[model samples]
Target chain A: MAIKDLPRDEYLLKGHAACPGCPITVALRIALKALGNKTILVIPACCSSVIQALYPKSGFNVPILNIAFEAAAAGASGVSAALKKLDKTDITPVVWAGDGGSYDIGIQALSGALERGTNFIYICYNNQMYSNTGIQRSGATPYGAWTTTTWTGKKEHQKELGEIVRAHHIPYVATATISYPEDLYAKVLKAKNMKGPRYIEIFAPCPPGWRFDMSKTIEMARLAVETGAWILYEEIDGQFAFTSYSKKILEGRDRKPIEEWLQLQGRFRHLTEDDMKKINSHLDEKWNQYKKS
Target chain B: MKTAISLPTLGAMGKTGTWRVFRPIIDVEKCIKCWRCWIFCPDGVISRDDYPTIDLEYCKGCGICAHECPVDAIKMEREKK
Candidate 1:
């Protein structure tokens, strides 16, 4: 169904503390529409904790458990177990974390929950850096991107956390972005209906962290998929297939040069032609594996 | 206030509209009523009925609505001093 057909109820309320054109809020708003009121969000120390606004008042209409930086999945597991005990099978427990929380700090907790087959949804909105801590490089930060921690550009390639999640053989795993709201909506809705550890990673481009114009947030997200920098797909049980524009790209659609996506962000400004070659070659290798599959 | 549960309420962090440098103005004549602006608005300030009406009290003036609008129906204009 089209975006207009989605529920019109507002779960994320007005007058929050999110920066102008914040990517996290854009993604969360769409996801909450799919999640509805029966959702309890388990948020770790991330931008969302701040976006929920100060104590005693929150922008989010749903109940949120603000946990430590490395306790999102652990907290959600507990919530899931408690809900099951309470016979509230309809209430969904969701872990909404950032790259720093999911890929770096909270990975162990996430893995444990998955291996235990906890019935919950874990979504990592990967901005690729610790944006809440003023843009430090994280495990999800791409190669040749500048962060406060990586002054000359990050030499290591980003960690494939999605692949790691898929290895758990969960009932559902997906990748989405805010640019394609319907794709994201459908994926989250599908995950909500499932009864096992379901994981979703959304490629969220931070406007301030990526050093792009605030208005260009959605454009940056669109270019990411069009350039093949981010591939959207969902894995159900053992079956895997691409989704949305990524499926078209896999079927011989032309991929825009990664430079088109890289050049707009100031984080990639330090890259030389040589650096571009390295990045493109790395991306090619990744795509080649996909092409072979 | 001492309670651990923080029930969400409107304007929790106070009015954020004062942070705007450029406010988006919708051209109703050019508007297609696609709800793109309403869906993309981060703060949930834009409410949709027949046409969308932005609540300036918390509109962050991010210009995302203007940028995402297909018909160029939304324009980002400098806020009055």
Candidate 2:
């Protein structure tokens, strides 16, 4: 469906506390449009909590339960159970969190909820660092990227949270990015209709954390996919298939050099040629796996 | 005991227009009205009719609309201090 075909309802209201050109807000706007009014958000301690603004003045039209940093999935599970008890199956319990909340602190709770077959949507809008807490490196922070804690660069590669969740063999799991709104919307809408645990990780490029021009957020995200730095795919039950531009990349559409993506972000300015080689080899290995899959 | 809860309201943190260094000006004559600007806007400030109308009161001058526009229909002009 086309962009105009999407619902015109505005669940994410205007003039929130989000910074100018925040990718999280952009992704949320599209996801909320798909989710519609019968949705309750379970937000943890992330920029989204701040983006929702202070008490007595919310930026979102939907009800949101702001929980602790590590309790997003657990809180969502409780909300899902309560909704089930009330026979309010129409309402969706969505956990909107960041990398710090998902790949790091909340993984245990998330694993528990998924294992229990909790009916909820867990979305990790991974900006690759603890952006809300001043750009510290997190488990999802990519190798050779600078953060407050990683002054030189992060020594380890990012945690494969999607693969970890996929191990649960949940009903729905997808990787999306802010650049492709339609793909993101479609995935969220599909996950909304299905039962059991759903996980979608959106590659959100932070303007401040990634150190790019605020307006270039979409460009940065697009470059990520174009460079094979990020792959977009969906796994339903046991089946898997690449989607959108990533589908093209899998079918021999040449990937642009990762440097095209890296040079744009200030966080990667310190990455040496040796580091670049490591990053390229890692990407090759990932694409090789994708090809084999 | 006090509780923290927010009611849905526009401009939750006061006017964001002042935060803008640049303001987007749509060239109505050149407009294609594709709705890219309307969808990509983080604040949900742009409304679509035949053409798009931006709500400058809450628009943070992100320039995303200008950057994402397929055509050069939108321009980012410096906001007057």
Candidate 3:
């Protein structure tokens, strides 16, 4: 269904503080369409929080609950349970925040919510760093990436937040992006229908944070999926299924080197040919093991 | 086969979290001015004249139009699907 006809409902409107071409903005629009106007949005201190001004003076179309930076998940869970107790189970609770909030400070809250299978959706809009805090490095920052904390160049150490989320064995967990509206919208609709906590990590490119052309936000997201950098998959009941990640890049089994993908972004510009080989080999090995195990 | 890549560019963030492909298609009929595909295209491959045109020449097929199309005009046809 076209996003427009999806509904005339307004959950998130324009004229916000998000950077130009911010994928998160698009993601919010699509997500809202799927969620309809029946959701209560939970946000933390991230770019999204900035998208709307302080409470009572915001630009979104639904009610906003701005919680602590590390309590998005926990807070959302509370709302979900509270809604059930009040017999308002029709309302869907969404914990929407940035990577830093989810993978770092909020990890504990997220874990707690997942364990109990909170009846809400936990969405991590991963822009890859603590973008709101002056580009500080977060656990989600990629290898060889250069964030404020990893100024010298991040060593080969980046955590797989999606894999970790799936490990919870939640009923629904998927990686989506603003670039693919249908897939993203469809996933949101699917998650909305399912009960319990659902985790969807979306790649929301930040222009000022990532050091790329403002116009290439969606391009950047596409590159992430095209290359083996991002693997779109989901885990249900322990058996995982890939959604968009091509097996071609799987294990570097039958694909080209990773250099083609890295060269497009300035963050990896400092790496030498040898560094690329190391990165490629590492990714290749990881993919192989990921598929095997 | 030429395109512009201006330097000093502050590229956006990539999930690098997965590998996926999303391609865009045009309905030609359902597509009305709107200019969404032309205005929001990250690659600038969409035509600017009257209607939206996909320059397969340089299109990486990210399916932004399909995602952003106000009407259900654009659709994502997975290369493999």
Candidate 4:
């Protein structure tokens, strides 16, 4: 869909506490536009939890249940069950979590929920680290990206949270970014229509955490997709297909050099030539895995 | 605007304008009225009327509206003392 075709209904109201140019806010806005008012958001200890603001004053137009740090998925599952009991199945229960909550802390609960075929949408707005908690490194933090815990750069590669969730043989799993709102919106709509566990891990960039100019959030997100650092694809009932942008990359379209993406962020400013090459190869490996899948 | 214990009423109740370091000023003559700034504003402070109107009461002056304006219709000016 064209950018102009996106719905203008503001489910995520303005005056939110999110940082200027915050991608998580953007993601939530776009996703909620697609989900509509009949949705209950279950957010854990993440930026959204704080961004949603202190209780008695919320940034969200929809009902949001703030849960424990490691209980987003579990909390969502309970909400979903309650909806079932109340015969309010039309109301979509969504787990909006951060990478810190989903990839590391809440994985066990998420895995169990997915295994039980919980009917809900689990969206991990991955800023690559524990951004809300002061940029501490999380499992989703990419290689060669500096964080408070990883002063030099995170040595290990980002964990494949999508693949791990897909392993549960859920109804749907997808990867997206705020840059591609049409695709993200479409995926959320599709997930909302289907029953069973659905997961979409969005590559949301944190300006303060990633040390990038706040205004460059969209540019940075677009560059990540164009460089193939973050692949956009959906897996449905074990069938994998690359979405719009990633499909082009998979179809022999040359991606922009990884440096174009890396240089835009301060986190990678400390990297040497060899370090960039290492990251490039790591990206290549990841792309190859997606191509094979 | 009834107050209930449910959810905080929408609109700029906090008067977040106090948080502004830079305030956005729109040039009506230059504005195409594309609503990009209105749509992209995180605070939803920009009104989609005949001309874009910023409700400064809630506008935190993030400069997003100015930054996203394609026609350069909006400019971020430093907040006065």
Candidate 5:
């Protein structure tokens, strides 16, 4: 669907504490529209917790419970259980977390929740690093990208959180970016209709963390998908399928060079040609595996 | 140090327009009424019906609307002292 076709209902509200062109804000706005008012958000210690605004005056019109850094999944599970007992199953319980919470600290709780077949939506708005904590390097931080903790660059490659979650054979698992709002909206709508644990990892770019122009937030997200650095796909009932943008790339469409994506951000400014070559080869290896799958 | 706990006043704080180094100016003649600016504005300060109107009292002048506008109808003008 086109951008104009999106629902005009604004649940995120104005006067939010998010920075200019914050992709997470945009992502939440779109996702909440799809989920509607009957949604209860369980957010952990992340940007969302702070950006949701200070107490009683929440930026979100929906009910949100701010839990501990590692308790989002568990919190959502409890809420879902209570709602079920009260015969309010129509109210959707969702966990909105960041990369630090999802890929790192909260993984154990998330794993347990998914293992127990908790019915809720868990979305990790991955900005690549611990953006809320002064841009420290996290497990999701990409290799050769500088962070406060990784001054030179993270030596290791980024973790495959989507594949890790998919291994659980959950009812649904998908990867999306803020650039594709329509795709994200559709995925949220699809997940909302299904039962059991659902996970979607969104590549939400952070301007301050990634060291890029705030105005280029959408452009950066689009470049990541267009360059094939970040693939868009979904796994359902043990089957995997590439989404609209990634499907074209999987069909042998020439992706924009990785250099174009890398050069735009200051975090990758120190990378040498050899470093770029290594990153490119790593991407190619992943795409080759996708083709095989 | 003592900490104070209180309910948030919710947008009760002073206007954020003072924080802007650049203020957005909307050109009605050039506007095609796409509503992109209204949807993408981080602060939700833009209101539209027929043409877009920016509420400068809350607009942080993020330039997101200006950048996202297909017709470039919104321009960021330097904030005058």
Candidate 6:
């Protein structure tokens, strides 16, 4: 497909209260632009709920349902079901939720929707904390990161949300980041056209929450992917194939040390050499498991 | 003579954005003493005395110091442009 197919009229507009470098807003904008105007959003009580705002001033150009904290997937499923009842055929329902909403509170509803093979796009913008609730540590938070609940640094437990979603045998499951907007847009667009449930976990950077600079939002995302803190790959109905694996990163010829990425954001500043070794081993284990599967 | 610092190879943007040299210019007039920046800095590259000084050796072009300036004191403008 040509690049023009990505479209230009962004559904998520420029003015919103999101911090200067909130990558969730960027991912939403890119995803909506790719998904086009024939889309409806179900947002839970997370950063996007506030970012979308009240009745008339939503950042979204399309229809948006301000769902409850734990009902984004269910709300989207309900919307899809109601549309079918009304004989509607063309619109795409998108369930957008934060890390806390998806990885913890909304997992049951999400799993139910996926199990029933609901035709909807589930996009989880994982900034790894309950950011809107004052940056408390959540199930998605990485090891050695400092949050309000983990001021001494998070105690080495990060949920494998991607693998858990992949277990549902959705039509599509992918890990993407705002650092790769084109890839992110392309995946969301592909998910839009697919017939069954689609799940995309986007690693969005939260500047205020992560204690990062507004300008370095994209930098952090890039680092997250490069350092293997975040993995980028795609699975089509459980058929795993990594699309963005470059010669350098895969072959290790031109790979910059992962530390280059981590040293940029202060969230990982607490990571000592010992801690980093453990993280490396953890990521390697996850990667090898995916390969074996 | 100092060895040159290389560009980040993480390439999460898939080789999209180019590394244009950026230099931070801090306006002393608008300088806020809160230093939310110095506290959150990962690299210890920004040296704060009266105003913050960016030591390029450890500065990875993340622009955290420039972006975290609560006041309009620090500006991260393109060096060549």
Per DockQ, the best of the predicted structures is: 2
Q: How well is candidate 5 docked (DockQ)?
A: 0.38
Q: Residue A33 deviation, candidate 2, in Å?
A: 0.6
Residue A146 of model 4: what lDDT? 96
Worst 10 residues of 3 chain A by lDDT: A3-12
Interface RMSD of each: 0.9, 0.9, 12.9, 2.6, 3.0, 16.9
Clashing pairs for model 2 are: none
TM-score for candidate 3: 0.77
How many times do residue backbones clash in model 1?
Answer: 0
Off by over 4 Å in 5: B1-14
lDDT of 5 by residue, A74-121 (tens): 999999899999999899999999999999999999999999999999
lDDT of 6 by residue, A25-118 (tens): 6677678777888888888999887765443345456777777988999999999998888877689989989999999999999999999998
What interface root-mean-square deviation (Å) does model 6 yield?
Answer: 16.9
* Cα RMSDs, all models: 1.2, 1.0, 11.4, 3.0, 2.6, 13.5
**Which digits, one per residue and each the tens of the lDDT, describe model 1 over residues A1-293?**
77677778888888888999998998999999999999999999999999999878988999999999999999999999999999999999999999999999999999999999999999999999999989999999999999999999999999999999999999999999999999999999999999999999999999999999999999999999999999999999889999999999999999999999999999999899999999999999999999998
Candidate 3 off by > 4 Å: A1-10, A54-56, A245-257, B1-81
How far does residue A101 in candidate 5 sit from its true spot (Å)?
A: 0.2
TM-score of each: 0.98, 0.98, 0.77, 0.92, 0.94, 0.76
lDDT of 3 by residue, A1-293 (tens): 55334443435433344554567766787788789888899999998777664433565667778889999998998899899999998899999899999998999999999999889999898988888878888898877877778876787567878878877889988888765666788888889998988999988777777787655677677667776676676665566777654544554545545666667667777877666777787787877787786
The per-candidate TM-score of the B chain, in the order shown, comes to: 0.91, 0.91, 0.66, 0.85, 0.84, 0.60
Q: All candidates' lDDT scores?
A: 0.93, 0.93, 0.72, 0.85, 0.86, 0.73
Instruction: Decide which is better by lDDT, 3 or 4.
Output: 4
Model 2 interface CAPRI class = high
**What TM-score does candidate 5 get on C-alpha atoms?**
0.94
Backbone Cα, N, C clashes tallied per candidate: 0, 0, 14, 2, 0, 0
Sequence-dependent TM-score of model 2: 0.98
**Judged by TM-score relative to the true structure, which candidate is superior, 2 or 6?**
2
